[model samples]
Target: MNNNLHIITADTVREILDQYPLELYEIIKNSYILHDQQGSINAPSSFLFFPHRPESRIIALPAAIKPNQEKFNEISGIKWIASYPNNKLKHMPRASAIIILNHPDTGFPMVCMEGSLISATRTALSGIVGAEYLYNKDKSCKSLGLVGNGFIAKHIVKYLFLLGWKIENIHLYDKFSSSVEDFRQYIQSFGDLKITIHDSVSTLIESCSLIAFTTTEKIPYLNDHNLFKHKPCILHISLRDISPDIILDSINVVDDSEHILAANTSVHLAYERNKKDASFITATIGQVVQQKQTIPKNKTIVYSPMGLGILDLSVSQFVYDKVKKQDLKNIENFFPS
Candidate 1:
């Protein structure tokens, strides 16, 4: 194993991604394909919870994406990520993470990268990718409804631009009006979309052809069955906002059914409510991508990826390659060999 250890900062990671955004999306999509081909090892995430603050958690997600026909190099890593909602009260970012990529052959740590941005970027791209595949119709959306206007929503909107998604209108809703205005201003910089801030979540849901839930809800609150009457493709990114009845009534596709159906997610709750029956979940996003599963007619389709770690490792590998090409410094002998 190479003894050289490299440390990449968040600014560098973000800068590299901003320059080559399409590459990030392609790698993530390819990672999904890798997992689908049975060429990946995705272990269930281990959550570290605090007794004093139940809302906060640190998750260790470890995965490996093996070499595939997509020319994706083998990558293995773990993302040590923490989400502390209380951090917001202290004016800190609610989530912070670090990804460690190990050498595929030797299993030695090769790179340690700031992972919050990587996490957010992969999440944004993966959701859109699955949204496109699960969507039976055209790729271009008329209007996208954002249920929560936060950091992930910001990343989603940015990637939409990067990938040239021709969304003519954007309807947004947030529990807090301050965040609504803040996100409105942030999106207005894009110039060209009709921005509508809805006082009601249902109005936003009813208004758009595409909808994304990016909230931090720990429980199922939105039980309205009428929200999907328009048959919009829902990007259930936050995972727990929709109710069991809604989930059962919808056409759901997930990155991995087993991983997502655990952890008491809305789908998990649905499984529990229905005596652990998971037939309601139609297919994995890979099945949708490979056209193995037919996306049917006139039902609300939901794409919820359980945040795969292989994608993190893939993106980190991308960043590592770019950093090397640019001749960034790696601290030799940092491992005390």
Candidate 2:
């Protein structure tokens, strides 16, 4: 197998991931634990912004998870992903990506797999894990609000069900009415859930106990602190959606404080507004997951995950391992020496 490497396609990646939804959650959870324990080298993502089209960007995330004697072998990889918000208007996906994994022992590239699915799946899992840790799971969430009706929102809904969240109501709001309608119909197929489409963001925000913002907004738009009542759980998945005032008023949590603070995210903005003080960032998800930090329940909780590269590595490695076991026939030779 020295001369051969596998080139996994998007369809295969989706198939494998769909087959083991719970396993994907566990993989992401363990990866977060490993990340908290400092078992991984997570480099900051490099951004390539378009000057002409300022909304579009391509990011390079390089990461490596240290070897574990019992669980995972040493692995290093990079995910090169691009985001073009206008692609939706052109009737295409907003993001596309590929991951290249290097051999641990020899530093030779061993796998090249389609990474968009991995990216979405891992991201969705991260949000769910944050909710699992930060949200009051014992208390039932009757209404779920999705601020953006996009691919990431859809995946979040999918994994929420996979994780057995008994959400009876789903409130969806999008700038585009067509996207909201499509999302409403898609979630309706799941059955036993009430779906409502809202024309305004504030209306949707007020309707749900668990709210998720998955839009492409680069700056803070939701600034009103009083809009958040009843100590709801906010999944700040899109990073920059919430204003710093809201972040300051809420109990803040993050995937990584340092990484998330660098990208001008809502958390980053909060840091900036507060004279670069980081006391507002209460704890990382790893700390919460490990029970090292306790998130107070009296205030609204905002989880801002910067979308770690280590997570991409974990999910990509999982896909590679699964493909090797079940679909050997699809393997391709990268260097046929």
Candidate 3:
């Protein structure tokens, strides 16, 4: 079999997002198997950490096997996607990653691809998927309140726009006014989107039917108003962005309970600290989309994505294939033995 490595850039991802739908679905499908490992430190000032360090790495490890052979043809592959944001300010990129595609049989490296866009797009599409399953297609949703304006928020807005969700009103509240203003200008380039700067998060949450918490905040700074009960909204809690009380009050759906619980990062930590059972997790977003389970419309639904490796691998696989077709490459050898 012909083997080669590929290097994919941020622009490559934009092209992928622009053209391929089937490949996108495949990536989302495979992402289900990977896991998330967000954690924290007790050091001075305290910090949240998602070390792609060792063990618990959810390697996609894809392969092909011969029918009658005792051993199968194996390929080497490992994907690592991780991120950390301290405050809503400082212009921090949410996630950075390195995806290793290798020869499994020979234990040699194959290719390396840029994972930032893959990570961002896969994550943003998740929110789109959430909107698909949770909200009725006929329902009119014009106003959206985004709690934090960060890297992830940009993509979420993009997907929402792509889905034909004529976002007539955009409400934003970030700790830094500059970030929020910058995001508004970036998204405004898409079209004549009505943008409103919320002096307070509470005002924004109350005004819009849909809400997204794409912040690095440790807790929800909003009032007691449970907006989830009002309409089918998305709480895309990337970090510990919302409060434990909010989590308990809302309908909790996640990418993977096992992965989230294992990592004990973000909202998962709140549940872990409160000694909540994993069974309490209402549903996995895929299962809901696939109709494995049903969630009530009356409840506020929050989808916590752990940013699994399968997502990185799935998108990286696409980049690898695209690079091969164009004859662009990054060489990494497998089976050094």
Predicted structure with the largest lDDT when compared to the true one: 2
lDDT of 1 by residue, 11-92 (tens): 8999999998888888888778778888889999999988988999999999987764466787788999999877867878
Q: What local distance difference test score does each model get?
A: 0.87, 0.88, 0.62
Q: Model 3 residue 135 lDDT?
A: 61
By TM-score rank, best first, the candidates go 2, 1, 3
Clashes (candidate 1): 0
Which residue segments of model 2 deviate by more than 4 Å? 328-337
- Which pairs in model 1 have colliding backbones? none
Q: Residue-wise lDDT of candidate 2 within 96-214, one digit each (tens)?
A: 99999999988778888999899999999999998888886553578889999999999999988877878878999999898899998889888868888888999888888899889
Segments of candidate 1 deviating more than 4 angstroms: 67-70
